[model samples]
Target: MRHRAIQILFCLSVLATFAAAQTVVEGSVRDTSGNPVSGAELSLHHTPGNTVQSTHSAANGTFRFSGTEAGTYTLTAAAPGFFSSVHNFVLRPREPLALTIELQRQERVSEQVEVHATYQTIDPEKTGSSYTFTREDLERLPDPLLESSNDLVTNLMPGASDSHDNFLAIRGTEFSLHEFINGVSFLDNAQPQFNPGVSPQIFETVDLMTGGFTPEYGNRFGGVLDITTRSGADLGGHGDVNFRGATLDNYDINADYGGQAGALGYYLFVDGFTSGRYLDPPEPRELYDFGKGARAAAQLDWKWGSKDAVKLLLMGGGTSFQQPNITDDQLVGRDAQRHLRQETGILTWLHTFSSETLLATSVYARDGSDRVLPTTDPITPYSFASRAPFTLGVKSDLSRYWHGHFFKAGMDLVRLRELESFFFDSRGDPDVFPAFSGGLKGGQASFYVQDHFSPLPNLTADLGARYDYFDFIDTAVQLSPRVGLAYHIKKTKSVIHAAYNRYFSPPPIEYSLLASFIGHNAVDPSQRVGDVRAYTQNYFEAGWAQELRPQISLELNAYLHTGHNSFENHEISISRIFVPINFHTARSNGAELVLNLKQWDRLGITGRFQYAVARTYFYGPITGGFAGDEPLAAGERIIPAFDQTHTGTAQ
Candidate 1:
């Protein structure tokens, strides 16, 4: 009886071992003629445990490492009368992977063998109109003067207007360009005031999503610019310094350093510039406008292991500009001066459990202050005194990915505080004008999820949705849904894509808070109105990309933007007070055509053409009562501000 009981216990232990979950690495060995190579020996070694699993390919050229644990591994395959080969692969829990190994007949037995690992592209699964430029492309620009700052954006993107300096208008929308550095956004109210920005040389790549963006992005309705800074990889150390000089007594200096030490890596970039008046002056003078600024950014990264990392990023900058308000080609003592200073920082932690699973978390903060002294009013003559429009904010985001699905959710909490002391009297009392002082504190929280799936050989689909809640002038909540599909033609290397997205954005805190000052401190009610909430837009896009030749390609895209709850500020009687209103139903339709040519014997060319028509129908107290117009004659439909019919660029 004792012997029989021991036998039963041993049998149970054997069955349990086989029933447990295990990692399986399976593959086949083939010859140059695609014939199965039998009697092939394979060895797999786990990196962490240092354990080895061996197998032999069957006559059908099939082999597998079954019942093995999950870990990083090295696999070596050897067959008689063939060159030995090695491959490195990883296995995650409950995930099985397959591979194919091709072996060539050996001319001579050698000890040296080069092992190559498979790599994949980081392109987003979603389909949209997107363009990417790497460091190599930026360095190859024909003009050195256009290599710094955000100049490349205007030069390359269709529907981008360069009529104004350092400003871009995309798809008929002005003041709606949102910028993100390493997945963290720089918020803008009504204008692009995020100043003292980084130099382009400090970035590794710049990605622009023109339209039909996914739910992972928010806070902007027009476009998205995603900038990725350079990183110090496993390479020991590297750095570069660049300097340029141009006409009009303009000069710039840029320097950067990157290196890796043990488990830590670091990168730093510094830029400075000084320029004599470059823009054509409204009126000729000794000096019309000149400015200078300096910016610096640094990052430190620590690698906990092959799959986990932590990074710290810090940046700060300041700018000062002087403009002599000239009249009749003569200097005026009432010169205008403006100063801006900004600082930003972020800390991030990232971990990868397998090839298909990842988690990332980041916390960030920003502080900026703007001081403007406009030309003194001829009447008040007291410099029209007002000062210090300061901004500060803190935010955080969490990202997770599993298989082919991605998710991101975060909150952007901000505080906008300002002192409106612009009033000044002829008596020069400095406080003669009623002073209005206050601040606006609010934030937005959002959640989004996206999935990428391939249901057919040449077709892909992506679906996502986002929900947002804003705590501001008027409490509001919104839900947006986005979807895209792409089809590839393998024979021609072409792609057809279509996308639809619903987008929502709230007015800037500074702009939304102005509603409170309507009747406060003797303020005139005729100058302002109230009621602010989030803006919503619907985007539809379709595009086709074709490779005409080995070095050339062409793309054409068409899009329509239909939106309501548009934010517009109206001046009742040309007074300083502007009432904010969501007064327009806006519609814009556009098409873009782009041609690209790769470097052929030292020269590359790119050209783009765009055509768009944007219109807005305003219905409110002000629009209905224009004196020169008959009531309901045109139903309040008119061309809004910054509407351009045709825009193009070439380089």
Candidate 2:
């Protein structure tokens, strides 16, 4: 009877785990001697595919994480002077027993090796007009705005404004895309659209790939951002607290750490934020934008049987954003209130087979919803929201550090559980507010292979291609080829660099839905004109990098770009939706000048000046497709959206 009762209770606890409405995970890290070590970078990978979070250790050498969903994961940490520590861990409703770490530092008593050898880290001045900002910079610097990474990075650009107080445009480009965690794609692909929705507490380093990019990158027509997250071990029990307020109160607390030399190591973290109340002057009425959110991510690593290491990670979070109602009589076309809520969960496992190769697989889910009270006269739904586009993928990497050629080969299998876009409704039909759904079950798949060949000490070349298979198209393949050459003027601390490449982008799903709602009048929309063909862009850049001194530098780049399959609004249709009928070829040329002055510690300035001319030739309206070859009836060239004739930025 006793044994039977015990089994019954165990079953009950397992079932209760899922109903907790929340999950909790906790662990720690240490050195081989079982002592706390700070500044270790840690990354949490969830199951299926989305990135959960990454963080670094605090002064106390400790950490803690909570509010997690049940799943699998792998945690990895490595420091410049220490050996790598990889851990695997799991989670439930409540199953964490204070973990510890005992790391083994590489005992190298011989010739020293400098680990930071990247182009920007080794010498910022040699790169001309760029400056790298570690997390430490954001800690000491003061930002007048709140919860905006884009607003901050752009201000640091070579030719940005001292403050983005208004709708500021750079050089002629109205929007700039910033990548998250080293991803090639910006979090929100649509430029100039924002709400300061991201929280910066969960990041590592933000690299500003402003210009002179190699062949690996595609089109944004402006700059590239490469972000690397913190994936090191906790090494000790330490955490931190940061808070800032504008119209309300914002508070946050974070803790995480790892275990000792034992076969099992662990890490955990938890954070949250809430706001106060305020008002807007437009309505001359009281307003309140209240937001509350929380997150927890943790991991454990298990290495057994000598050569095998398995890592487990569990992550989950919830957030809520709301606003008070606005009265119709008090304003024009806007909303009275808005509410947004999202819940996320992730789990992952990474098994390492050898020193030169590893396989990582993960799964992640996001349940996001929104509500709004816009005017009844609006054509679209009063509230815009989506719970689709859930992501899933698998990634693997093979690397070999040989004598003359350093090689790394990897591939990512990505897709969406829902349609590429679930917000579209054709036939001028009304949106099913609060019930937004994407009709796509299979979106797109991307595959690529790249090689880095260095024939000399200061010169490097690369070649690669990305093939994408989308929902509406048969197959889209982009051949990306690029080369870079740099020369260092021996002892003068100056370098010159030149690069050339091409980029491609297909019309996204949102444009398709606009077509569905096509009407007979000027506002008519359709499902994308004649299954539009592929679009391509060519890029060319040449620049010089000069380091006058340790704290000062300058860079100048001249560029030219030409595009194929350019889509524009068809003159025959006054509709805001799409009609793929109107098409054109484009040409853009520009030059940028960047200057840096960090010569004086604690007091420095950086800025840039840009000049570009954008023009497109739209073939006249479609007549069996050949008619588009003629110029538009209006005869005036259309200016590129990114074109900003004379623009400047400073920081």
Candidate 3:
């Protein structure tokens, strides 16, 4: 009887151990249309232990995991051409759990779906403030192709307004915003005064980041406009042509073609427009404002095997316009013509080492030239100026997911060359402007690393650092650190976020070099041309977002920026050539409220409101070009002329 009892106890212990290790998790992947999806990558993450196990679905779209420990886990499924799906659940000992993951087809191109997924999931993890216009939102515009991209920004984005000559100002900061097309910077494309007016037809999405961005973004202080061009993936073949004629002798023509063959895809877009009222005129009756321009852009994508892909982009555009004239100038028969040209080429390669790791590298070149013809009015003849700027750069980024943490690192190296000329034709009068010509060569290097992770179930944190080196007329180096935090209150359906960021922005290349040249030449004895330095700032932000209903959401955010060497621009004595200037100290504070109502019964609405104040004290000694003699009064706070205290928009 004793032997039997011992045997029974041992058997019972063995059975219990076996049962604890028998936890089975199984899942099937399917599309929204109820069709099975094979070869989908799936990952199972143990929340408490921070362990991850990955697998792929079989031919029948079924996957299984045995011997999983009982705990809280997150399961994620990702596949090509589909939106990723995530599921969270608790596993119990000796219990078999079955799950069905339904993925939604991505309507747009598939080239950057993985990259897009990272951003789509950022709302819960990001502490920054941003606004996005998706393809669907853009399609709703009555004339997407006809409307200027700047108009969309000024009309819809809070704290954004049009500055002098179609330039954009955010939070009273002029010439501080940066523009990117398909992840490539276009900073040197054309002079700062001209807007390329890229056709909206080629845009897949537009994202505007106002403040509190990560270290991956640098060299800009006010804002960043990130645009993703459209692709032809999954589209067999399609084309569109549009033409419109309106009053004021204005007309526009746009055409686009896209298709996919085998593993390669291509998209092409071309547009031309002529407008009688291109530039805002000083008088009610527009005169000498006629303008015409043409643009062409193409994208090619190729994918091979399962781990590698390549993309090529080419773009070129040219614009010729008559500078608008004031009533007095019109009466004097004064007319000026401006011509602008820009071209860009980029090649990018992507490789995926595993389900949790991705790498991307790109090599790009951009060239731009701007010329303002000399006016022959004789009475108020203006000098002619031209600038040709070229840029070549290489950028690489690596992304990895490990142990519930998302990590990213990247580096950028850029070479810059600029050529500039000015012809005044003073006609032997020294009082008139003298002719001058010069060029500059420089380079910049930047590196950054960041990690995003959840320390608790409801709290997420992002920590990063950046290093930058600039070698131009002067050498400057900076190291910046960034931190962000987000906390979710599930019961209240709200999220509270905060961020602290240090920013370093180098001066604009063309303007900085021009300032150096002017100082060396010293056309005027009284002109005090000081050295231009990189701008530095400390930014702080806090925000709260709440979901009122399934389709309704609201967000309120406040930000403060304290910086030195704030950037400003001044026109060169009515010549329309802008030069960079700076302030000794600058401070900006603002609050914004945004309300979004998703498509409910086919009706969607978005509303935004902002209140801001921007002030600067003491003009920097580095005033350049036309502003060489700007007064430098110490400790005098001056409100920026472009500051708009209150702005509201609804759509």
Candidate 4:
């Protein structure tokens, strides 16, 4: 492409902006092709703090950003398939800035304007690679009586579908992901899944950072899921009861764990859900849940000494979904259909080293042994698995106007292990079916460095990288790098953002399938993913942002990704090894749009849409055999099953 930009500003009148006042800015966005881009974004920025106040874009290739301050600022226009453009102007005291911004053909994308949607905006200056979830987001809106935190993960950015029961797949890696318990990796392995929060009501925030984080984080090609519990706004003890008619009935009560003595703080929370069967007069069979769900948690904090502070969190829950299953011979329930039980726990601590350096560590453990527990055949009815991982790390950050440059450094170590067991069904053609199972253990350590360079007031850039080591595989050393930049449109409110990040992902389980044939009455059945070897993923995205007004703005982003040695979740059988031989790769492309309205407080609205295709072919020899209408046709691909023809959310 070529270096190009187009900035158009339509001010209703230059004299009207004499008195500073709240105003509006509305305009149209077109391209060199003389075609109007309907979803193009318009952004307006106020001076100082640069807080994102609003966002919006209308149909007919037109956008209106209202509630802006009457100050001399800039206006920017950006769209996925166009070049970055800006409009610099002087907003006097009153009236509105009616401007038109036209973007050129595809050109280099900038950092701030890189994301096609408003939701992609993150304060990169604060953290490099972190995914945050605002508790108020529609996805977290309190559900009637949901029991498990396992299913809540699907709503997170970069999170995958629920593959195996309770089995989570992060990025392309299935089970290698790290789940945190209040910042500490799990030490117990009894939870049904890796998502740590059991009841959303107890947590105030949930963040998941896939990679490119500071040294304080541990080793793993996957990512990290962090949970923060809410603190009691009041000091006095408080309690409340939640009573409602739904699939589950809930009741809760909590107390402040500290008093006026010394310097200590803590809060306790306990709640339980009764199955419909336990209700008065009892509920119908169709709604008769086989088990009740219960959970309890506590958050504690205190000053360890003069310059140190310590915080601790405790949480646990129990849940199961039992359904009716019958065979041809008996109408009565011959097989019990159920979602089993799991346990979880976590602990974390932190100490300060003056204002420039801080030290901290966390420990997490979880056990998921909730098996079928067949009522008739109680002995080895199903499989039982557990995982425990510990993390220790330190961080040092300096904040000063030293040459107008910022720097940071950190390092961390992680230890991981898994205990698994599997059993065979008495009716599984018992002859050929083998009763087998096994477990695996591994550990790793990693470190990283980063720096943000600001040479001029209108220009900024960031660079960083990380290295990790593993024991299970040779050449364990791995590197992850990231880069970003932003350019301010002279003195205007307009700015552009573009970034590139390189992350590593573990392959599926099939790559390790050879292990099953070598075992004697012992096997893991499948590794991390759906019985497929792990595959690595390298994603690249570019987009832009615009401050159309102080209260309304918009963003446009486009991305193309490349995947090598990709693995597919396929069938597994003896003698046949694993279905779909490994060693395959592919590519994909897509775009997204986001809108925000700050004027409407009580009513919040957001929307996102994506179109991408991922495909892979059998790596093994296929000379004479026909590829057969493409094992995965363009319109027939399912890698991203949720890649709906039309996916959306509204409230």
Candidate 5:
């Protein structure tokens, strides 16, 4: 009967262990003589988050850390008559680990030992293929074009193709497709051109993910550009200023000020620049075109307590430029000048409910406007258009760990408004073409949940799904699933990773409005075009990374993406107005190889090579298959104008 009762109690305890939400870490501390070191001070440090927990050893040299999250941590022990020691370890979700540490006597003759602690929260596991750049890295890169811009950094990366002047095409896909600032969409007005308005002087770090992105990021088929700005806490209570000038009569000025007092901190940044066009021109014309822009940002941070914090950010910028209209390799009398402005405000709150649970919430709004003014030359036929796009959004995310599984769930809601107008001619004549103007208001919502499961010490799997809904599209709900696997070979310090994901990109709100205008003349609103749908793609990727030596590494990856129902502009009867239509399907495939070597930290060398193939097919002539081809047919394939077969870069 006694043995049976003991067995029943053991079963009950095992069941309770699986039901618990928190985890614990316990260990013992001993001196050089293998004796219990009671009252020794121990500190636990959580990387990236910088949260700290401390306790003293018990009378039996045992220490217990209860209610702690699963993550990478650094533990340190310090006591009198002994040298301090540090250890780095990973805590698995809901798993208890026991460890022992032995301290040496201070009197032992020894030399100083240097220890380096690096916090790499961006890619802790090194399972993804990406490149990270800091503010200093951006300044040292060679520039033959004599331009200081973000594009310079991306164009040099492996697998990057840039045939166009400003756009960056990766793996044969569209350029500048996805951009994020602090995990939120930053560039919404991407049609005609896409440019990140933030200045590099204020950027703390930039990460480019070419493959193996997490499920939390969606809505783009290409790569992702993640940018994080600097905070006032980084500078403590100081200010900085910088100025750069080149031979092309170009000049730039940037300034910043930041400081902290008590529990509050503040930061401010401003930049202004002018790129003189006369120094370098495509052609020698009597006329000239120049570029000018300015950017400014401010931030405030507040710490309520050990478990709560708040951050507020404000940013605004404007860009203006002029381009000469060229016909038959000659300058035309009429030129085009454009001005664009963007502003954004955001507030974020972070609270730690417990060691095993953390919550983050944010509210943000952004606005963008554009104006185009052309020379009023009667002979030249010019178009005038103006637009104002606004977005208001709210987001909330919750993270928890349980039973060796890390879970995250989040949702976002956004409202959009676009006020726009356009005309065929800007010669101050109404007879040329009647102006078309309208407004659109809509909203979008998304929810996602992801789990990072570790079934073995060397293997990890990430599985997740996301659902998106836009009120303006015919396909109201779209679902996307993502999965990735990673394995670490302990002996070789190498990693092998693979992933498969489904991607969806809803047509831009501005373009959707253009499609709705197809029925502007119809008396009944229900008769308007109703067949419009969002784009979808399936992506497959596999890669391997290994460090050949202490300062040299190599990486190779291959990817393929197949997409359908892609959106494009099709002219109607050669009229001035163009309507958007989903008229084509495409396939893009590519492979990349990169070799990096760092010798002595003062000089670095990098080489990249890539090969890509892209082809598009149209179903029918109504979808603008081919205009003047003699063999025009219902189903035909052709290469896009932007597609490039092979590209390479070395630096």
Candidate 6:
């Protein structure tokens, strides 16, 4: 029955991709001097429908509108220091219209224009620190498609660092981050150990929030990565292809195409690559680490009517890499290999009751699996592990803006099933190494409500709460509260913000079940593990931002987190399979400084520095795997393995 449901969903997604027709409008915004005008606001008013659509010009001054009804329309473009431009045109059904609008400089600005410019420069509604990278920003990076996205984050984001085993650690927190693609959880289905690969070109925008998040987001304490995929809307049949080659026989080929036909729009991307060196090796010279992988993604949008729209996104990929072995281990011919596969699909419906009110609902499914081929070497003997996780979920969000307040509410429900197996040939050392296999079925539900409001012209506040419930090997429930505030000082061109959030993160179901099994049935009494518990945290942050000039800005922020049952992962021996462990208490504090210089005519600079301290105390016997018996002495504070005291980056 489950398989049938999935099949039906897939079929619908494919069928919906071909069903609609509408008009498209695309253009670029430029100044009188022939320079591109970035961040220009545009509005299109339809005469027949008496409706309006609004958008902002991209960094390259491009803008597009898709799925519009054939009618007479008036288009207006406005910027902070330019005179607004207006154009009137008639559109035909199933046809695309293009234009280039130019804006003229204005000597004096009105009070209203000054207010608009201030709002554009500093977002008063933002209560926390965040960084956003557009598609153009990523394209500037060298070999973006050839490297993992983690490299981008660690290099560009302040307080972000690379942890051991290809994991990302933010603000001294490791293995506790959440990744979401188009409002669906990706990390939950694909564990970090598998190192799922995604091309940067697939993303339209990547927003990383380091602190001051609202209650609407849950399940992670380190940070939140919100990603929006590319779409065909407003792109009038545009495409690109690229090929890259380097030393060591490494090569990559990638392409993307997007366009709109009538009411239907589509975007497709595919990438294939092979490399002589994949995973980082312990030795200077990589050995037995050849890797290859291919991935493809598609997005379809159908605006069947003026008030309703449907979007479908599908992605699937697989990778295979040979695990490198040390020189001594190479003598025994250790040739372990790891293979990973993942597929995700999401269908969403959007309804617009009015310009100020909207509702979006989505149904998503995800499947991920990892297999590690055993290596039979004399010293290490044999090692093997397999994991498969399936997820199905439904989510909905309603947003309404009234007066000076914006209100949002959402709910998410998910069903999870996981199958995992591990085996290690102890070679007469069964006391420490054992084989195990297990499967689990579980469900999770969450509901959240938040409000962003301006009590004063320069002061904004965000208040919200959320409820989360989880059921797998055990049941856990939490009610968390969130609060944030931002105050802008017009005289100084500065903003001060602060936030407090309570977070709840449940342990992964498969890992928790495995820990339970090991604890109950251990070959040796001393090796018995204990039950894993959910992690909870209280996070606080405060920051200040100053606009030094029109093109330069500086920011400083500090954050602290106190957590219980802190989550951690550890690999078993030399095998790549990782297990979850918990500490009794965890504390982390950090501060970061950032400087940015933008729009200097083809030149940009960014610098960041961070200092942090992280410590965990009171180790647990339960769920610690082989370290079950190694408990910390009372009053002892030890830094986490992934902690870094100081980090700095300049780009």
lDDT (CA) for every model shown?
A: 0.57, 0.41, 0.68, 0.41, 0.59, 0.70
Give the least accurate 10-residue stretch of model 1, judged by summed lDDT: 623-632
Model 2 vs. true fold: TM? 0.60
Query: Candidate 2: minimum summed lDDT over ten consecutive residues — where?
Result: 569-578
Top candidate by lDDT: 6
lDDT of 5 at 311: 64
Where does candidate 6 stray beyond 4 Å?
1-8, 11-122, 187-192, 283-285, 428-431, 602-629
Which regions in candidate 5 have their CA more than 4 angstroms from the true location? Answer: 1-127, 139-153, 163-165, 186-196, 276-289, 327-330, 426-435, 473-475, 510-512, 515-532, 567-581, 597-633
Q: Put down candidate 3 lDDT per residue, 420-513, tens digits, no spaces.
A: 8886654443434456788878889999998877789878788899999988767889999999898878678788999999988887665566
The lDDT ranking, best first, is 6, 3, 5, 1, 2, 4
lDDT of 2 by residue, 429-545 (tens): 432211223344444445555444446655544445545555533246665554555555646656676666666554433232222222111221322124444456676766776
TM-score for each of the candidates: 0.72, 0.60, 0.79, 0.59, 0.76, 0.82
**What does candidate 4 score on TM?**
0.59
**Candidate 5 steric clashes:** 0
> By how many angstroms RMSD does model 5 differ from the true structure?
11.6
Which candidate should be chosen as best, given TM-score against the real structure?
6
Over 1-651, each residue of candidate 6 has an lDDT whose tens digit, in order, gives 224335646765555321122335667899878799999999988643344588999898988765454445678889988877876554432223456688877766652332212112334346888766656556666784326567666776677766654566777666655666666664362233564656667876666678887766667767766666767664569898989999875888888899999889899999898888776665677777788988899998777666787777887778888887778768778888888887777786767666556676667887777898988566665788888878877777776666545677888888888788888775554325667888888888999998877788778898999999988666889999999999988789898999999988887454556666665666667655466667888989999988776646778888888877776666666776667676767788888887765334345553333343433333433334334445555445677677777787766
Question: Higher-lDDT candidate among 1 and 5?
Answer: 5
Q: Write the per-residue lDDT of candidate 4 for residues 1-651, one digit (tens) a residue.
A: 000000000121121111111234555677767567777666665432243233444565666553333333556667676766766443421122335466776564453344222211322132123334433442334453234444445444343334433344444433434554344443222124222336756654555554334333333334465555544433345545555445444333332232223566666777666553321211223332344556777765555463454544555555554432223212433333333334443444444443223344444334333333333433312322222222222222222112334444544444544343333353442223343344445555656666656556556666677666653322245687766665656344555656666554432222132222222122222221122232445655554555554434444444554554443333222111112223345444444343433223345534332221222222321111112122432223334322222222222
Which is better, 4 or 5, measured by lDDT?
5
True-vs-predicted CA distance for residue 600, candidate 5, Å: 4.3
RMSD of each: 12.9, 13.1, 15.8, 16.7, 11.6, 8.1
Candidate 4 local Cα displacement, residue 573, angstroms: 9.6
